[model samples]
Target: MTDYAIGDLQGCHAEFVELLERIDFAPARDRLWLAGDLVNRGPDSLACLREVRALGNAAFTILGNHDLHLLAVARGGARLNRKDTLDDILAAPDREALLDWLQSRPLLVRQAFDAGGDTVMVHAGLLPQWSADEAAGLAGEVEARLGSERSGAFLEQMYGNEPACWQASLDGIDRLRVIVNVLTRMRFIDADGCLDFSAKEGLDSAPAGFAPWFRYPRRDDLRLVFGHWAALQGRAEGARVRAEATDTGCVWGGNLTALNLDTGERIGVSSHLRR
Candidate 1:
């Protein structure tokens, strides 16, 4: 089966459908690794969520910041931003099912290959201190909370930037928040390995003493695929680790991109949104 990893959908359903057609995707024969942010900021949030959900086992998704924000808002844990286009999803008849499915998704997914390397997928980037397996374990900590009875309470506490640095002794909400941030909201990290939420632009916009997380030294046995940094336009690499970016900013008038994991080929479809 062909495995294709696509960037953040961000509610651009038409472009998503077109890209699928371009790749000649067959649900029975091909698998999809969606890099998250499946809904928000574009015109068709509900449709996008529905289409992906219908794909069932054919599609595997991780939660992005926007996806989590949607859950938080629905649970009264966060407020809607002025630019958010998530109303359609929140108001849909299948909203509960969608949100439940989203919350049930893991923060990290790893696919092992017989060829001696694995592909690790996250919505954003990994911390310098985490090996892929360690990250997966930490991700499970948050996933357990999200899938438990206290999930609503956890969502309420999931919205902060405090405790920016990681520590082995961290526990409770602080620990969960750090895991969430590193997996979903991280971009650049300070010299001390603390997350810097200041910049969302390209590499040139990195704050002083901070650099893209992928640039730091890490394990080399896995390929890290991520979305969320739209300004990168599907281009990012690291000296010590292999990283691939797939977010091409479809919601911001750029093209939607998908990377073929096995063949390393990229296919894209232009956004219809006016710039």
Candidate 2:
């Protein structure tokens, strides 16, 4: 069975479909891992959500910033920004089922296969201090609440940048909020692993004390699979650690990317729709 992971869909349904056809993706045997951001900013959020949800057991996805944004908006936790393409998804007939399925996806995923050893996937990179199991445990807290009706309360508390450092002693919504942001919204961080939320520019030079989260030496254990920083362009491979940026900005006039985990082979499907 082949295992493939793709970058942010950003609601680019046309490109997503084309990528599947290019690979001749067989849902019965091949496994697909989506790096999240399944909706928003592209032309067809509703269609993208429905198609992926229809994939059922063939798909394995984790939460991304856009996915959380949709959840937060649905909970009335946040207001929709002008660039957001979520309105179409929110107004769809399958809105409830789609959102329900989306919300149920994990903040992090850890899978052990014969060739890749232990693999951990999250939307953004991880702090050096966290192992996969440790991250998974923290993610479980938010996942449990999200699986319940009380999720709105959690999503409302989810948006912020306080208590800015990781502490095992942190509890309640404040603690969980920090965890979710690190796992989803994080990109650059300081030597201390504290997040630098202000930088969006794609440059080799970081602002003062900050560095890309993956550059830190602490991630020496499992192989990390992540997207979200389109600025990185594509894959940043390290000895045992890596960042796979599948969201090559298909919605932003770039191609969609997929990586074959077993061979480290990459496949791209252009956004032009007609391949």
Candidate 3:
């Protein structure tokens, strides 16, 4: 019963399947932890959805920025960008079922055992200020509503650029979007953990306003795994907390990576140039 956490799929269904086969994954025993962005901006977005959804309990997927964008567009609250690969999904007959399944997935995933300590997974990252307990509580609120009929209303409030800071008192869509961005889209943030969404450049060129979220002092208390920054290309340096950047830029012609949770071993399959 090996457990693996994979990098972003980004609609690369073929690679995803190949990686599983390479590892000889058994759905009944092995578990797959997805780092998020399971769809969009690549071929086979629909196929990815169908395949992962079929995995059922064997696959635990968190929501990525692209995944959330799909929900927003489906709810008519957001526009589909030019690079989006979600058209096939939005136009598919199983769109409703797919979206429902996606929304039902959590923003944070935790695994615990009697021997080993707890490990938590989030799509992107947790704020430096948040404890694991706080992250769990906040993510649960959104997940419950996302899996409910009120999900449409939640999607409506899911889009925006304001309230870039976290406040415990925040309610409604403003609060939800902030949490989603931090958990899914975050990469670099300021000392105050204010998100720096504008700078997508390489690490050395990060703008003056931001620092990597894991760099925040208090983050060392938690054992966490995250993705969402292809720019990092899977470079993580820390002591107590393991910041694993699994997105190898497969959508931009890189490999897809998977990590063995129990052994901390990493395996990757090439994107084969995506020609």
Candidate 4:
């Protein structure tokens, strides 16, 4: 019963299936931890969502920025961008079910290892100030709001880059926004420990005084698994914590990647999309 953590699907259904086949995944025996972005950007958003949702209890998924964007757009909180490929999902017959399932996902997931330590999964990265347990607790706050009747209103105010840093005193929408950004949209952090949303290219494209979030020292023994920065191409080393990057940019004509949490093995399937 191995647990595999997969990178962002981004609607690449064929590659996703191929990767599962390559790994010989059996839902009855093995469990999957998905790093989110289950839909959008690639050719088959609808199919991807269906496939994951059908996995049921065998799969655990955290909410990515793209996933949240889909929910927001569906609820009239945001508009689709030119590059988005989420129309199929929006127009699907089970759109409501899919969106509800997605909205209920948490921003952080943690699993403890029998050998000690833990594996923490998030769509992007965690704020330097947050420990694994603290992040999970904060994520629950957003999950509650998203799963409630006022979710549409929360989604409407979910966008933005303000309150760029974490503060215990933060409340209301501002606090929720910070938690969401750190767990979903985060890539780099400035010297002051604030999130830098401007850079998305790669490590070298980090804004002045900013570096990848994992570079900061974390006083925990947990391993971190995350997707979202495809530019890393599934590698980010020299971090204080044991961080595994899983997004191999399958939507950008790269490979779909999965990491075996128990064995420290990585398997990848090349994307069919032309570069």
Candidate 5:
């Protein structure tokens, strides 16, 4: 059984399907790990979500910023950007079911191997202070709220970047928002673990006294597999920590990519659909 970690779908369903076919993926045998942003800004988000959901246990996923935005928008808590192509998804007959499936996806996924190896897959980065286990627990805090009966209320408060850092003392929306940001929107962070939202450039562009989250000393705990930062493509790595980027910007006219978790092998399929 092969295990493939795919880059963000970002609504490029055709490319996703093409990549699957190129790999000759058999859902009955092979497993798939999706890094999220499964919709928006591309051609066919509905199809992407439907196809991935159809895979059932053969597929594992995490939530991305855009994916969360979709939930917010669907619940009337957020407005759609001009570039957003989610109209089709929100208008689909199965829109309720699709959004339900999406909101049900966890913010972080921990894939354990009996070989004493484990990898944490999140939409973005994890705070340096938390170990993989702590991170998963942190994620659960958000997942539980997102899947609750009042999830729409949670989405209404999902936006904002305040509290810019982690503090166990935080409660309510602030706590959940920070957790969501770190696991979905974070790219660079200061030495004190305060997230820098403005700097989205490569490593050399890190603000003074701030560095990529994966470079933090304490991050070596879990082998992290994340995808939100497309600038690094599929090879974003750190000095010692295992932070692998799978978002190759397929929606930007780039090729879709997949990385094999166990074998460290990667495969690509050129995007034939318009971004």
Candidate 6:
């Protein structure tokens, strides 16, 4: 009956399992909130996807940039990069089911707490211009098209960083692309709500015009939970929003983190890799 929010898996299946064990997670009773990137860059992409998919209703996962990239590559819209370890997933016997499950995941996850407020989880971060409600609506827009006939054409259009800001008037691929970026890859956002893609370090190293997303005015209206910034190592400021960055860089030999939703308690387990 407990809920735990986990950081990126990134194909580190062993660490993922160990973290579950450490937390004494029960697949039948405990619900897991995964912060995305369920596959890629580590030893067992297929295993990670299958394990999470096996959780059924017990797990709620969002789509990370890597997850979308896998979809694009599977649909023939993109090539497997040199560093990608996703071939096993693409070649698996249950590839269709796995891909379908992954594709069906939402871009935004909303859970109501007992204290009368709720938390919204996205893979990366939200734009300053968006309220949690607006962002959830926008996420549904991408979810609708991600696995449809239009996705083949839109997947190719999904790669760019152009139109780096969100606009109500944005139409077609431009709008979807911006939504995907902010939800999956954003780290810093300018005061005007423009995304900054260059820097990956912490807030102190922010580029001249940008600041971390949680620091923006009124961002605490809805509590935000996110992953994808390994540099943060499970730490994000802005207590008002309870902003939590759970990606502890397990794929890079750091630990995997899980947060207790009701208690706001965080626990970490080291990566299985000897690195």
lDDT of 3 by residue, 55-163 (tens): 9999989998889889888974688888898999999999989988887889998887443357889988889788888899899988877877454677777766688
**Error of model 4, residue 212, in angstroms:** 0.7
lDDT scores in order: 0.89, 0.82, 0.82, 0.89, 0.86, 0.87
Candidate 1 versus the native: TM-score?
0.97
The order of the candidates by lDDT, greatest first, is: 1, 4, 6, 5, 3, 2
Question: For candidate 5, what is the TM-score?
Answer: 0.95
lDDT of 1 by residue, 8-64 (tens): 999999999999999999999999999989989999989998999999999989999
Error of 5 at 143 (Å): 0.8
Model 5 regions lying over 4 Å from their true place: 114-116, 219-221, 273-275
Better of 1 and 5 by lDDT: 1
Q: lDDT tens digits, residues 73-148, model 6?
A: 9974799999999999999999988988888899999978885267889999887688878999999999988857
Which segments of candidate 2 are over 4 A away from where they belong? Answer: 237-240, 273-275
Residues 143-198, candidate 4, lDDT per residue (tens digit)?
A: 98887845478887887999898789899999999999988999999766698888
TM-score of each: 0.97, 0.94, 0.93, 0.97, 0.95, 0.95
In model 3, state the lDDT of residue 17: 89
Cα RMSD for candidates in order: 1.3, 2.2, 1.9, 1.2, 1.6, 1.5
Model 6 CA lDDT for position 130 = 85
- TM-score ranking of the models: 4, 1, 6, 5, 2, 3
What overall lDDT, based on C-alpha atoms, would model 5 receive against the true structure? 0.86
Give candidate 6's whole-model lDDT. Answer: 0.87
| lDDT of model 1, residue 201 | 94
- With a 3 Å backbone cut-off (N, CA, C), the pairs that clash in candidate 6 are none
